[model samples]
Target: MRVAILAVQGAFIEHRKKLESLGAECIELRKKEDLEQPFDGLILPGGESTVQGKLLRELEMYDSLKEKIESGMPVLATCAGLILLAEHLSNDEHVYFGTLPVTVRRNAYGRQLGSFHTDAEVKGIGEVPMTFIRAPYIETADEQVQVLAHVDDRIVAVQYGAQIGLSFHPELDADSRIHEKFLGLIADCIKNNNCRKN
Candidate 1:
C-alpha cells in the first residue's frame, strides 16, 4: 500500500517514518505533481496550519487535495491536520480544507507551554500514547462525526467517514496502533477497489 504525507512543513518526517515502519510505501507530497502518483491514503501531519495552508495554495495543491479528501479518500489528519480538515475553527476566521464536520479551537491547549503528553483511549483502538504540542481540540463535532477519544474532557480524536482527525501526535511516539488503524482503512479501500486513481 502507498501513502502520501503532506511534506510542506512541520513534523511530516516523523509520520513518514511511522508509516514506512508499517511496510507502506511512503511518499512526501511537496508539490502538485506528487499527487500524480497513486496513493491508498494520505496523512496530514501536525504543523502550523497557517503555514501549511499558505504553502498548499502557493504550490497550487490546495484545491486538488481538497477534492481528493472530499471524494472519500481515507485520510489521517493529526494536530494541525485536524484544524485543516475541520469545517469550522471556533476562534479563527480561516479554514483550510474544511472537509470534516468538526469545529476546532486552535492551540486550545494554550501556547508552547500548553504542550504535554498523556495516555488516552481511542474508541476503536484502545488506550494509546498521545503527544500534544500546541494542539487544537475538537470543540464540537457535527451529527455525522464520531467522537473517538477525549482528554481532560475535551475531544481529542474523531472519525468522520473514511477520514480521521486527531489532536495528538501519534507519529511522534512508539505506538503504531493509530497509524495501523489508518492503514487498515487503506487496506479496506484497496480490497473493495475504492481507491481513487491518480
Candidate 2:
C-alpha cells in the first residue's frame, strides 16, 4: 500500500517512519505536484492547525486534498489534523476540509503543558497508548460518525466513512495498531472498489 503524508508542516516524519515500518511506501506531499502521485491513503499529522491550513492554501494543495477526502479517500488524521477534517469548531470559527461530520474544540486540553499520555481502548483496537499534545476533542458528531475511543469521558477518536480522526498522537507511541488499522481501511476500500480518485 502507498500513503501520502502532508509534510508541509507538523510531525509528519514520525508518521512516515511508522507507515514505512508497516511495509507501506510513504510519500511526502510538499507541493501540488506531489499530490498527483498515486497514493492509496493519506495521513494528516499533528501540528499547528492554523499554520498547516495556511501553508496548504499558500502552497495550493488544500482544494485537491479536500476533494480526495470528500471522495472517500482513506485518511488518518491526528490532533490538529482532526481539526482540519472537522465540520465545525466549537471554540474556533475556522474550518478546513469540513469532511468529517463532527464538531471539535481546538486546544480543549488547555495549553502545551496540558499534554499527557494514557492507555485507552480504541473500539477495534484495545488499550493502546495515546499521547495528547495540545489536542482537540470532539464535542459532538453527526449521527453517522462512529465513536471509536474516549478519554476522561471526552470523545477522542472517531471514524466517519473512510476517515479516522484522533485527538491524540498515535504515531508518537511505539504501538502501530492505529496505523495498521488505517492501512486495513485502505485495503478494504481498494478491495471493494470504493477508493476514489480526485
* Global lDDT scores for all candidate models: 0.92, 0.93
Q: Could you report the Cα RMSD, in angstroms, for every candidate shown?
A: 1.0, 1.1
lDDT of 1 by residue, 47-151 (tens): 899999999999999998898898888999999999999999999999999999999999997665488999988998899999999989999998889999999
The candidate 2 region of ten consecutive residues with least summed lDDT is: 189-198
**Which regions of candidate 1 fall more than 4 Å away from where they truly are?**
none
lDDT of 1: 0.92
Model 2 misplaced stretches (Cα beyond 4 Å) = none
Q: TM-score for model 2?
A: 0.97
Can you write out model 2's per-residue Cα lDDT over 24-137, one digit (the tens) per residue?
A: 999999999998788889999999999999999999999999988989999999999999999999999899999999999999988654799999999988999999998899
Best by lDDT: 2
TM-score of each: 0.97, 0.97
